[model samples]
Target chain A: MAVEIVMPKLGWTAEEATITEWTKKDGELVQRGEVYLLVEGDKSVNEIESFETAILRLLPDGPKVGETVKIGTLLGYFVQPGERAPFEAAQMMATQAQSAPSVTADAPSLSTVDPDPYAGRDKRGPKISPRALRVANELGVDWQKLTGSGTSGRIVEADVQAAAAAAVAAKVAVVQAPPAQPVAAQVIAPAPAPPIARATPAAGNATRKTIAQRMSQSAHTTAPVTLTTEVDASEVFKLREAIKGDAKRSGVSSVPSYNDIFAKLVALALQEHPALNASWTDEGVLQHAHTNIGMAVQTERGLLVPVLRNPAAKSLTVIATEAAQLVERARNGNISGDEMRSGTFTITNLGMYDVDGFTPIINLPECAILGLGRMVAKVVVIDEATEKTAIRKMMTLSLTFDHRVVDGAPAAQFLQRIKQFVEQPYLWLTR
Target chain B: MKELTYTVAAREALDEEMARDPRIFVMGEGIGKRGGNFNTTLGLYEKYGPTRLCDTPISERGFVGLAVGAAMSGSIPVIDFMMVDFILDAMGEIINQMAKMQYMSSGRLRMPMVLRGCIGIGGAAATHHSGSYYSIFSNIPGLRVIVPTTPADVKGMFRTALRGNDPVIMLEHKNLLSNKGPVPDGDYTTPFGQARIARAGKHVTAVGVALTVQKCLQAADQLAKQGIEVEVIDPRSTSPLDIATILQSVKKTGRLMIVDDAFEPCGFGAEVSAQVGTHGFDDLDAPIRRLSGAFAPTPYSPPLENEIVPSVERIAAALGELVKE
Candidate 1:
């Protein structure tokens, strides 16, 4: 028999956890209650234990320490050492087998039939087991007087015990009989499955709620001044690949996508252009001294901008790590609200979809929101004199700034700095 | 003294706090010789020694748990999770244990544990190591959550977290650690559960935290161009949320809009709306609205991720809906 190892809910909030360490080697024999692995959560670290003695079979080797292991993921297959276990076949059969027994037409009617058949239909009778009926024939407490508490409206031992106690309390003569009596069992019928209905309307309602809310606050209340520019993205893409490769070689699983580098560049650009790192406040232009950059993350659920704190101080490796984590949390619908708030400058990237550019709303109280699009190959004159058309990778940059806080010139300059950083990747790296 | 970034302000807070209190010490991964992942604890090792600025293995749960134990044993332990994203790696310790230990022990155990979490997304660390989760700690009963948007706030909040009796999760926005703000050299602590009226207005009220507050302030400035005046409130401490300050602002303005960078289905913005809807539902002239990150995981691609999160347009649009209502 194989016992399924499912993701344990370490905390009350969520079920998924990141596997940090695996204590046992694959195919090694393990005893019950032995520590198998260590899982990391939002709050604490927990050690998972084996409940059954078996051999371990871990798949997807070299699973990174911080990657999420979802609920119901098979951590490993349990099998006896030196013996082939047909756990897979059992699992398949279990899935195909009927969950509950079906009702047979030849069986007695469940709802309308009399609970007990020995007495007349008009006279209520106590339901008795085959053994209880024989015992009652000898002692004679009226079977009709005994009540039932069991399922299918049948009599149970507890009911008999209560009646006997009540008879004794009432000073009625007790009929002594053998203690062993057949107990009636309840027949449980399979529950009918509920009819399936479309979920489109509920989903549509949620979308409408979001749209209505966004339309009113984002469009009407704030004066959104969008600034657009095009930047060469060849270097940004190359740098990302290089970083990811280097990190992998070093045993540190770093997935620095192009967005991560853009975030870093924006953070640096905010340093150069402090005007863009501000939000318009009621107290008249509240200038933000620190540049907390927020990035837009697209998940199955909705759009979320998880801000990376103090990007200026961290290395590219650390930044890459943090960006992956935040985006993953956002996608999983597990990110907390605090992570979403407090972005001095926002970066929205739609590069992967191959879209050139689109206007993005400002993540208010921040002065500017940067929109990024797909990196495409474009013909450029390598040398003006030669007129040589060379294929160069390029992407569009759109900046939506709070006009009240940032003027068009500064906003353009912020985009210009972003462009320079992307083109000259080494400079951005140095910063 | 010198022009300092937000990270420097944090480092300064640590230095100053350590100099003032002999009982306070910092322990975390790469904090000693490496100066910390973000350099927020730079040079701290040399000044305080290994005992004070302790560095441990990549075991966040182990070290953070040790910090909680250390705190109850008479020492004030400041544990730094290299990144706020990584902090979730030890949520069990921070939330279930550190946050609830004192209360569970019926006040017999004094937990002076300060958790410094590096939060937010800017660098392209897709989905895992970026973004803020202050609400995660704030939602729990025993924890105090703080997100510092400015250099001054960083220093002030750090001071307050260190002195507080309960465990505090100090969320340090990663990108904000570098920009400079003036802070008093001596010592001063900003009280917890107080909202700073970053911007005052009469037409509408906007509430936010950390960088989102900055975004709301920006949205407010833009709204000013359209003859819309917005009052912006920043709750530095998320747990002991100052509902009074937020409600008062909403009552005076009659219009309320909440902008949060976190995902929107259920967030701090939702909490603000609930509080307003329940307390001053009649006083509100417009429907309370919240602008938050789209309900999704943060994407790695620039455009897709950008489209998914909350932006100025979204915040402004929500405010517009409220105004029209």
Candidate 2:
């Protein structure tokens, strides 16, 4: 008896579905409970598992990818070896190919299988067990994208354990990306650099494609506003000098960089001005509890922001140490997606290029981004009564916010607090 | 190598320890003069004299407490229970006082006592005489539980337990007393937490303690003939079980079977399966299988008793089903 695989009614209302992929070939040996093919309903894509163990024999009239068939229509059959095909040739050409994004609402979606099993899976994502699911969920592994190798091809607890080991391997792989040599190279080459062409067609690079899609998404959905302000950086320079001297006196090798100090101060300022530490949602605003700041680093691949979490709660030294490591890894291209995502706020510094604060785009879903410009010595009018003139350091701060989430005043207040910290970096150290 | 019965191996370990040290002694009901009901302490009574082999009345609680006191006073005492079923009578002395003595004394006092008992079902011993209580006792913090499956392990682990300065519960299976195997003439101690591979196979890893190890080896041997490779591991000591060996074997085999003489729930097999499931699940191809003594008390009928306890037939059949997956 050939077990008929019908087009299942995925939801109460959904009837006809398109057979998007065939996991097993027509004559492949198939086992019960093994995922055999994928069918797309209006609301969901269900991976169809075999109900009986037998050789899979697709009817010549079986539906193909992009062809929508009626509910209860036969998709394929599981037949005994040497069994004859019951149907003759039936090809219904696709009227239109409509491929929707497969990610499910609230729940994570899994594609059943393709003729090529690895076709739909993320090369970097891990397949794990149920307990491993909990472990990966805790350790932050995006599991649904992984292809499993467990019994009947389902992630098991051991797979999760292996995923943890795999996660370490992934991190080590990222770290092996050409080390700080590039960082040194970038610093040494002070040529009149042409702006890196953002729209140059790279042949078959998937990362560039993804970056284009993400940037388009941000630009499409966000109501972005850019605000720029110049702050007195004399106090910040003196604070950095004191920190460097104290660190040298104590035999500390790494002193807090200006970016590290700003990142820490911005996180704390965001904490005080909670309106900026949020995400845009249809239901309401998602007020994030922790201050995870993503610092944008230009990598060999593209611009990547490696997030350092809870920067507001961390000490200045800790922030400097962690931020330095994150930037180094980002540059090396060894940073995991888990480290790249989970950001509530972001900071991009072009101060290194002597950029006088260009309008950096908001890393969308996050409310705002703060851009730091190069600090330079300038003549300032001091002692207003005597009309005396003296030298003072100044830097530009550009804050880009999602205007829909926060109004001008709160955004301005958040930037002002950041400005106050920039003027008096020692105020944060005392706290 | 000398072929010795399990009983003779145990007696030899005690005799060797007693002769080597003046403070070493044996105390249990009907152990002296009669030389133990199972004859495991047969010649120890005569060799050590009445003072060293002081047999007590049928009072496990009192005798166990007195032995704990003897251990506290710098004597290495070996206390035997006529049957593991009666261990409940001395739970306070064994679990609370003796198990907690060293920690309570802040390491000042060392209770080097060995509470030896016979477990496992056969001979229609019924519920009272047949009980695998080591798993229950192994739960205590300060106590180390050991079960020897062969003459070699019996002799070796016995020597280790007798010499070490910690409370060790040595559970010898009643049915294995008459079984014999080759034992080395010289002194050798099998370290705790080290598992011995009795028969190596590739399809599944089977773990057993005490007599179940023998049964699993027999099963493994039979399975090998059927073209199914089964790896049999004997965790000579249960409490500090040789889980690493089991996990490694499972990593290779991806299938696991545990044969135990203890009841299924919370038994040594269950614990081993759990640890492997938590830590080695990635290596597992199928759910862990545990073949243990039935939850019911050992029936008085010999056939029924044999049916309840894990057997080679049951172990092989379980592995056969597992291999099919």
Candidate 3:
């Protein structure tokens, strides 16, 4: 028996994936556990291994490399040597020039009978209601190619509406419209310039398209409010320097970065303020028990957030090592989907690029995100009681939270706790 | 606004009309002293005297013919058939004489006659006492058929019927005689050919008549909980048949289901379905469905009678299925 090989599902949110490379070609012998192909999905590349050892028989009309296909699409077949593949047999039957056997003959030709009887019959087009047909025409949708979700497989008006909506969404993804102006605004606004002859723009890759969709969805769904506060990071800076010197003396390789420290502090603060570590859902607010902090890492392909599971429970050294590996894997575009999901909160740092304070879009389901800006030496009154002016290391923290989940006062309190952690590291680091 | 029962509201219309126009009189069995069987004429006999609220024997055809002559001879007579099924005996007088009086006389003679009756199958009324044959009168050329469901509608439509010069047939559901609702004070008349959107929705359009209008409203409420909204429309009159309102609703909803307590064949449901199918062809997303009484006659047993008519559950299920299409 020949085994059919199809595209595998990569992630929960992945609808399709592109086959970047195929190691085994046609007629190549493959063994179990051998990497057969590399598929890119959810902004990461994954190796698909062979489940059985057999001779590879690649389909002639299969998807080419870099061509994206839907999940479960048939790609090839693994068959034993000297066994005819399914498509090969069909092609041979077509080229044999065999006519239907004579009905009056003594023996009937069984080869003329189709193995799947239903495949040979004439298929009727989709049954569409008159209203749906009118709507499809008005919306310029192709009704014949659509599958109806109506009674007795009838295409209805709602199905047409959905197809129209999907078409508009695909157009938006392909156009990659300006981030400032929405699609609807662009449609209603007058044309800024006359049409000019230009080459066709390149369509965005699957990862970029997915990012655009998620960012747009988050911007639309969440009522985000960003609160900025300048914090004195002199204590956190000193704590990191002392930890680095101790690690160097102990011959420890991993030294905690500002993001790793912030992740730990945010996780601890979330433990105290459970509302900030909650998800806004239709049923109710989901207050996460374990603090799975997601550290946003900008990669060459796109932005990827690798989650650190229960970082609050891990030691500072263990968190530093794990965060370094997660960030490295994300930048290399080889992180698994499981390592990038189920985050309770997210922390994005742009301090290296000299970003001061900016409102960040909330990752969906997660309620709040903390953005870290660059730390600078600013002259300030170090002691208000003595009125002594001194140079202090200060950083601006921007906390963006969904108002629907937590009110202003609670979110501000959570941010205040984070500020306390940064200003006085001993308050949480000792525990 | 004042709350009144369906019977009291309709009686108030007759009282106001009879007091305003001396030529307006009511004639029915026991209507003079007994106030009719269903209190249709309640205490009006003493107020209007024997001449206006005259009592008559159990002769439907004879009195219907007498009222037809009175209507042609400059009198607005109201012939009250306690049960609408009794009007079958006077079909010839209604279809040939009453319906064709003004048309036959080339508009020279005005036929301002009000034929009022209690209709619908409920409370073991059986076939003889329970019949909603407004469709039959509606099929005729020159008759205004009104089947008002709410108390306010009954009062308002009855005022219109009493004031119009055309012959009008008012069919009041026996099950809704005591249904209380707010009615406007002072003069109010609901015009014929106008339909009321009993409940506004967006998923499915349901046009109901008589008792079925109430049933559809209940079904709409039930379906709303399930997120399947059903728009219930009550065509107050069958002759004019407010196809415009029904078409507009179908245009919005794209699915249509007609519920009538009458029989399926040649019933009010069939008539509305035909009109909507012809006028609102492109607006329909599903085949026009009719949830009506069974083809059999109204049974006497409670179970059998209940099984014949469309209940709220059946209407809701049908609407749910229609909206999916």
- For model 1, how does the per-residue alpha-carbon lDDT over A49-92 read when each residue is reduced to its tens digit? 88888867665443455678776676656765444335544553
- Per-residue lDDT tens digits for candidate 2, residues A332-388, read 877788888778888999988999978878776688999999998888888889999
Q: Write down the lDDT of every candidate, Cα atoms only.
A: 0.74, 0.80, 0.87
| Candidate whose DockQ is highest | 3
User: Per-prediction DockQ, in order?
Assistant: 0.00, 0.05, 0.51
Give the TM-score (vs. native) of candidate 3.
0.54
Count residue pairs with overlapping backbones in model 1: 108
Candidate 2, residues B230-295, lDDT tens digits: the string is 988888887787789988898778788888888888877778888999999766767788888889
Q: What is candidate 3's DockQ?
A: 0.51
- Show where candidate 1 strays beyond 4 Å: A1-431, B1-3
C-alpha DockQ for predicted model 2: 0.05
User: Model 1: chain B TM-score vs. truth?
Assistant: 0.95
Please provide, for model 3 over A1-431, each residue's C-alpha lDDT reduced to its tens digit, 9 standing for 90 to 100: 79998989998877899998887767666778888889999889999898888868889998998999999999889987556679987885776535533445654567453465454234436788889988886676877789889766899888899998887555433322323346434434457777677656444365675577667667776899999999999999998999999989999999999999999999999999999988765435756656899998998778888999998888889999999999999988889987987788999999999998999888766899999999999999868999999888999999999999999999999999999999999999888
Which pairs clash in model 3?
A: none
